[model samples]
Structures are given as C-alpha cells and as structure tokens.
Target chain A: MASTGAVTFWRSAGMTYNAYSNICAAIVRNCLKEPYKSEAVTRETVHFTTTNWENGIQGKPVTHEIFK
Target chain B: MAMAAMRREGRRLMVISPTVSLNSTNAVRSPLVSQELSLQGTRSISTQIVRTRMKSVKNIQKITKAMKMVAASKLRGVQVRTEQSRGLWQPFSALLGDIPSMDVKRNIVITVSSDKGLCGGINTTSVKVSKAINRMNSGPEKETKYVILGEKGKVQLMRDSKKDIEVTISEIQKNPLNYTQVSCLADDILKNIEFDALKIVFNKFQSVVQFLPTVATILSPECVDAASETGGKLEGLNSYEIEGGDSKKEILQNLTEFQFSCVMFNAVLENSCSELGARVSAMDSSSRNAGDMLDRLTLAYNRTRQASITTELSEIISGAAALTG
Candidate 1:
C-alpha cells in the first residue's frame, strides 16, 4: 500500500512539472520574434510607397500604372 | 470477549474517522477556496488586460491591412527596379573581384526598425541580433559601430550599450526606398569612419505571416566577386558573357551604393508584414482568453450559490428537529 501511494504521488508530480515547463517554453517562443516579424511586414507593405499622407493619394488607386 | 473488544474498537474508529475527515476536509478546503478566490482576482486582471490589448490589436490590424494593400500596389514597381539593377551589378562585381588585396579595418551594421510600437518583436529581434554581433566583435581584432534607422532601435541600444553610435534616422516615410536616403546614410557612414564591411540588419518579408530577420552585407567587394563568378558561369552555359569595363574600384563603389538601396527596400517590406501578423495573432489570443475566463467565472459563481442553498436547507431541518423534540 505504501509503495503504491508513493508511486502515484511521484507520477502526478512529474506530470505537473512537465506541463508547467511546456507552458513556459511555449509562452517564450510565441512572445519572441513572431510579433516583430508581423509588424515589420505590415509596415513595409502599407507605407512603402507613400512618404507624406498630405501630398500622396489616399486609398489604393484602381487604374494606376503597374510599374514606375 | 474478542467480539466485544472488536465491537468497541470498531465504534471508536468509526467515531474518530468522521472527525478526522471533517478536520482534514476543512483544512484542505480553506486553502483551496482561498486559492480559487486569488485565481478569480487574477482572472479579472487578465481580462482587463485582454480587453485593452484587443482594442490595440484591432487598431493595428486596420493599419496593417491598409499597409498590405499599399505594398501590393507598389510591389510591381519595386520588383521592376530591382530586376533592372541586377544587370548593372554584374560588371561592377567582376571589377571588385579582380582586385584581391583591399584593406578591411572595421565593420558597421545599419539596423532598420520602425519608430512605432505594437508591430511586435521586429525591433526586439533586430536589437537582439545586433547585441549578439556586438558581443562577437568584442575580441581585440575587430571594432563594430551602429547606424540605427528607427527610434526603437536607438532606444534599445542606448539602454545597454556605450559604444560609438553614428547617425540615427527616425520617422522615415513609407515611400519607395528613396535612393537619396540610402546615399545620404551611406555617405555619412563612409565620410565619418573607415569600415571594411557594412551589414544592414532588417526584417525580410516573406509573407503576411512570415518575416525573416536578415543580415544583408551591403558594402562588401566580395558580393561583386560572387556576382561576377555566377554571371560568368551563366554566360558560359548560354553563350554570352556580361559586357562591362575593367574599372573594378569604380564598379565596386557603384555596386555598394546600389546594394544599400536594395537592403533598405527589403527591410521595409519585411517589417510591414511582421507588424500585421503580430497584431492579428495577438487579437486572436486575447479573444480566446476572454472566453476562457468567462467560463471559469460562471462555474465558480454557480458552485458558490449551490453551497449556500444546501447550507440553508440543512439548518432548517436541524431547527425543525429541535422543535419536535
């Protein structure tokens, strides 16, 4: 009985530790470079051509030349 | 006698068992309830944070989408220019390759990031890469300097480093990477210090969701050499060698200038894509977290209500029994 109880406790503790470690690792990975990449891409895509909002045409033009 | 003793022991144990269980249960439950309440408090705080983050994420998404549309619109023009410039770089690189004994003394890294926040880890990753590079160059043989393109990069570097920082240009407009800006930055770097290698660190846009952090070597005669060698191989295969003059130094200078512009253009595209992806993901997580908290809170509220009702019923039954007695 005693041996069985000890085995059960050890198994539960190990499982909990593994779960916690996995969660921490995931949080670190998700919060790191991913956000920066997305932001950088968005900025590049939207603002690459328009330098000044006042002078540049607002909204994408439908019938503009494909290349300058 | 054995049966009588056994009966007494069994009764005593039975009596002791409930008391033990009641005490133990109370002991366990008190802490568990306290922990539950603490969890509730944390959940509330997390919910508030999620709400604020959601708002910000939505705003960023709007901006990113707008930016994506803009990039799509301008991509054709940028692609054309880039393709045209590739032809010009061929002869230039062959010249630089021919000159084997050029002096290389220092390395300078120009890091481009955004002035704004909420785009995500684009700036942070760039800064981390820069720090790693700086640490690598801490050896006696090499010296590294920084030319920052965004306010965020400047702020991050300033917090930890006390090295020689050259120019910092912030609030760059979203224009087709102006050759003039690249030239000005290049001229400043060239005039101020003698560097053997120049690297431009920025995000390279692969897709809306994937932006790769790239370290492009902008001012290396080695690039021209590689281009020439590659060009020669292609020409041999197709029966045409690249037509260009033998002024390797002049060609190298021109190639370096063109390389700077390409690096800038690539960086801008990458950073914008990264920004959009971060905002979309952040918002998605926020909405899911909010839903989870609401479910947990509803369960706790129901459990507490049920416990109170059971207590009231038990108290009324005990009062009625006392009255009957």
Candidate 2:
C-alpha cells in the first residue's frame, strides 16, 4: 500500500513538471519577439530627447543669433 | 543473507536522502507480483495530467508573441518622431525666451500618458506627478484643470481625484506624434480661458529600463528665458539682436507659436519612448518569472515520480514473498 501511494505521487508530479516546461517554452518563443522588442526601443528614444531638452533649458544663456 | 544485506543498504540510503533512495529502491525491489500492476495504473493518470498542462502553456505563448509584435511596430514610429524632435528643442527654448511674461489668473496642466497598459509604470509615474501638482494647487476649494492625453491616465485621474479634468484625448497613436492634435489642445488652452501658466508632465526615457518622470513649465516665459541664457552661456557665445525686416510683435508672435508647438512635440515623443521602455522591462520580468515557475514544477514532478516508483516496488516484493512462502 505504501509503495502504491508513492508511485501515484511520482506519476502525478512528472506530468505536472512536463506541462509546466511546455508553457515556459511557449512564452519564451512567442510573446517576447520582434515588434514588442522594437516598441521598447522606440519608447526609450523618445524619453532620451525629452529629458535632454529639459536639462538644456534649465538655465542657459540666450544668444539672439541662434534665433536668427 | 544476500537479500537481507541489500535491504539494509537500501534502508541506509533512504535514511541519508529519501528521494534518491526511493528511485533506486523502486527498480531494485520490483518483484513479479500482482501488486506491481497497481503502481502502473497511477503512473498513467499522472502522465495524462502533464499532457493537459503542456497544452495550456502553448496557448499562453501564442498570445504573448502577438502582443510583442504589435509593440515593436508601434515602437518604430515612436523612435522616428523622438529623433526628429531633438533639433526643435533649442529653437523652441530660444523662442520662449523672447516672449514677454504676463500675469494671468488660471493655469492648465497637460499630461501625456498611454491608453493601453502592459508597458509597466509609465502611466503610473505620470499620474503621480499630476496628482502632486493637483494637490499643490488645490487650496480650500480651488481646483486645477487637467488636459490629459491617453485613456489610462484620464481614467486613473478621474477615478482618484474626480475634479476639474478639463479634457481627455484617447485617439492618439503611439508614434510619429500628431502635432496637429497637440496644437489644437494648446489652442484650446490659450483661447478658452485665461491661464497664469501651462505645465506639461511626462516620462523622460533614459535607457532601456530607466524612465524618469519629469515636469516642465510649458508656457512660462521665465523658463524660456532661462533656457536661452543657458544655451548661450554654454556655447560661450555673445548675444545679438535680430537684424531683419521683421517687427518685434511679428517676431514675438511667430516665436511664441513655434515655442508652444515644439514643446508639445517634445512632450509627446518623450512620453511614447518611456511607455515603450516600461513595457519591455515588464515583459522581460514576466518571462523570467515563468522560467522560475517551470523549474519548481519540474523539481516537484521528479520527486513525486521517485516516490511513486518506490511504493510500487515495495508492494510487488511483499506480494511475491507471500506467494512463495
């Protein structure tokens, strides 16, 4: 009876592990790809420019020539 | 005597590490007995459960892949606009410096964020800044009006504050920002009511994983003047007056509009980039978490399998001995 219970538990565990592995593999391959990756890049670029502008304008000399 | 010795060794191994001992004992202790058949039945059921779980994982992967692709396409447009707007900042600041300051009664703050989520804390950070501003302005019973970009920000602000949200625009795309819409918004602010100042709050994308929330005074002549003076001082160049046919008022009018539009353009670009960065980081973390879960589940499965095999062998050995004796 003890042996039978142990066998049942192992069998169930093995099945669950196999299922979990499949799901993880799918996530890595499908969802985190090209367009999604590129989208992140684009957002970073926008952030860079805005922050730079904010810093540059904080307190600088105004040359009238640049306006011309 | 040999069988007794083998059993003793197995018992010792089991004492040291039960899981490893269980695996070894299962195979060694197996006997040709009716009890062994029962162990086989349990194994089959466990296998079926594993198969079902694997199917669900596959389905989840497909959805994540689709979302990633969509985010990538939108990112391209966002990148282009952000780059183009880089040159506009200095000029816009210079123009702002030229505008004369005025004392007004009302103030409006335009906040840019994203309508959709999954791009991490971009919307949250923007909202936090806006909320802070709102609190600072609200005294006794007075409220500050908000011109919010993106449905998420609008919804969040409305839910939290539920006060003086002037306008919420939700139709803007991710990139190659539509200055036309921004212009319309600026115009509305300028014409509808008399405002003392105009401020813009947005995300300033620093890197792949760093997006800093920033607040800028958009309509303040003082900030513009400060920007101009800083730009000049940095270059170590002396200031000179414009020597052209254009009159002061004409120049001021042109400069003011230019400054406003440019600032609007910059804000949009920054907000988009921050949104993208936030999403990427969020997705990366999600992937890692999935990996961790897989590892734990795999370990559990292995342990359970070993336990089951050990039980089966013990039952078989006892049954065989009983039959023979």
Candidate 3:
C-alpha cells in the first residue's frame, strides 16, 4: 500500500496507480523529440463507429473519434 | 417403262436407306454422347474447379496483401512507441538489478501475447518459454502459476496446462497501449495474486526480422530485502539512505509496483511491435504463396479449356466428314 507521504501525492489526490502512471507516461510522451512527439500523440487517436437500434431497425452509423 | 420403274425403285430405296441410316446414327450417337459425357463432362468440371480455385486464391491474395500493408504501417507505429518507451523502464532496471538466476519458491509467470493471431509463431514461442520456466521451477517446495495476458496465449496454454493458470487477462490491446493502462493492469495483477517474484514472459523486438522470447523478473520488496541481506546483487540497496525513516517499507512497495508497471509496459510495447512485424512477414509470404497457387490454377484452367475446345472441334470435323461422305 502506498502511504500518503510526499512521495505519493498522486495517490492522495484520489488517483489510482494507473491514472498516475498514465499521467506520467503522457508527460513523457509530450516531452519526446519533435517528430516522435507528434507521431506518438497522433497514434493514440481511436476511431470507431456507433449506430442506434430501435425495434429491430438500425439507424445511420455515426463515427466517433477520441484521443487519449 | 421397265427402266423408269427400276429408277423409281432405286430412288425409293435411296430415301428409305437414308432414313434408316439417320435412325442408326441416332442410336450410335448415344455412345458418343456417353464418351463426351465421361471426357468432356469431367474436363469441364475440372476446368470449373480450377477457375473457382483460382478465384478464391485471388481473393485470398488480395486480403493478404491488404493485411500486409496494414501490418507494415502498424509495425512502424509500434516500433516508434517501443523505442520511446525503452527509456521508461531502463532506469528501474538499473536501480533494481536484474538477477535472472535468482531462485524464488513462489513464482508467477506473466505471459504476454496478443488478442489476434496470424503473427507467425510469437505466441507459441512465448507459451513454450512459459512452460519451460514452469518445468524448470517445478519442485517439491517450488510453486509456479501462470497469468496469461492475451487470448492467444490463453488458447495455447489452456490446451494442456489449465491447472497451472492463475488468471488470464485479455483485451489489453483493445485500445492503444499506454503506461496508465499497463499500470492499472499491473495493479490488478498485484491485487489478485500472491507471489515471491513475478516472471514476465514476452517477445523482445530485436529487429524487423527477429523477435526473441524473454523472461524478465521483478522481485517483491520482501524478496529484495532478503536478497540485500544475503549480500548478493542487491547489496548496493543497503547503502542508499531513506529520507522518511519509518516509511521505508511503504517506499519499497511503491517502488516495486512502479517498477512492475514500467517493465510490463515495455514488455507489452515490445511484444506488440514484434507481433506486427511478424504479421507483416507472414502476410507477405501468404500472399506470395497465394499468387503461386493462382498461377498454377490458371494454367490448369486454361489447359482444360483448350482440351475441351479441341475435343469439340474434332467432333465437329468428324461429324461433317460423315455427313459429306
């Protein structure tokens, strides 16, 4: 268990280890070199399609894109 | 009058003979039709089979080509991320010296694999390595359990060693990999199982053509303490001073968890890169083989078609000769 010491401020802030580590990783990614930084940032983008179904009839698909 | 009557009889005989010959030819034509049935029917059937086979092979070739392209592009992206993520775990590895030969009684092997297959023998290689580790570590006092990371490994490992598996985590690659996600996964594994040490099995990306299955070990804080007390590889840890006097255990636990996540993230990235690379090569070979198969099938199809055409032409010539003579 990680204690609420100065070393683990992220945990005290109600962030899980994953979230803290992800923030750290994101910071590192942002600090990368010019071309690699942009490439890494863009690579995290996800594209998916969503459609609604009502009464066995499908609606038009909508594309959703998110960057994490 | 006798000559005319004789000519009329001859004409009548000619007409009756022609009609009898036509009926006799129709009777004989049934056997020719059977011969055509046996020869041309089989020939056309074979030709149709070859044509359909060629079509399917062509479709497979197209699919493989597209897969190869997709894999190539993915490989480039993963390769870049792998290189970048190397820095994330290198410091931890330096701080926590890797003791590959360290013997631990309770071991948990985390086998890294991918959800999708067709990436050569990478999953098999990792699974084999995991099994070998289990064999090597099996003893009266030693216990080993598996925590498979992907569906590919789960399917491969479940074939024989279902009992050894502790937990199998999938969908790790469902989204783009990041340190946060890997850390969360590491946290989940830490919460679930109890182990003296964790042996992470994964494929190391050596190059575009080479992937090496590797096992990296991370020791629990207690194990680290034990190792340091024994004055072995971790002897240097005793020299470092802790700022917070009573919080040493807490600090060590945090360090161990962080190190585990870092190493796991790197392993995941490296494995993904290797998978993509392997897929690219595998699809390349598949499409090439499909092209070769298509070529052979096309040759057979053309040959059968030409044979059928030749047979039809010979039949036409023979029938015409019979009609004229």
Model 1, position B294, has a per-residue lDDT of 52
The lDDT values for all models are: 0.53, 0.58, 0.80
Candidate 3, superposed: residue stretches over 4 Å from native: A1-68, B1-46, B244-247, B318-325
The better candidate by TM-score, 1 or 2, is: 2
Candidate 2 runs further than 4 Å off: A1-68, B1-58, B69-77, B97-104, B139-143, B174-176, B188-194, B220-250
DockQ of 1: 0.02
lDDT of 2: 0.58
Better of 1 and 3 by lDDT: 3
Candidate 1 clash total?
30
Q: What would the per-residue lDDT of candidate 2 be over residues B76-162, giving only the tens digit for each residue?
A: 677677878767766655434322222233556778888778988889889998888766766654546777777688768777555
Docking quality band of candidate 3, CAPRI definitions = incorrect
- lDDT, residue B153, candidate 3: 90
Candidate 1 C-alpha lDDT tens digits along B48-86: 444455556556656655654554555545545544544
User: Top model by lDDT, which number?
Assistant: 3
Error of 2 at B93 (Å): 1.7
Q: What is the lDDT of residue B62 in candidate 3?
A: 97
TM-score for the A-chain in each candidate structure? 0.28, 0.25, 0.53
Across B35-141, the per-residue lDDT of candidate 3 in tens digits comes to 65457446444565667778889999999999999999888888999999989888887777777678899998899998899999999999999999999888999
| TM-score winner, 1 or 3 | 3
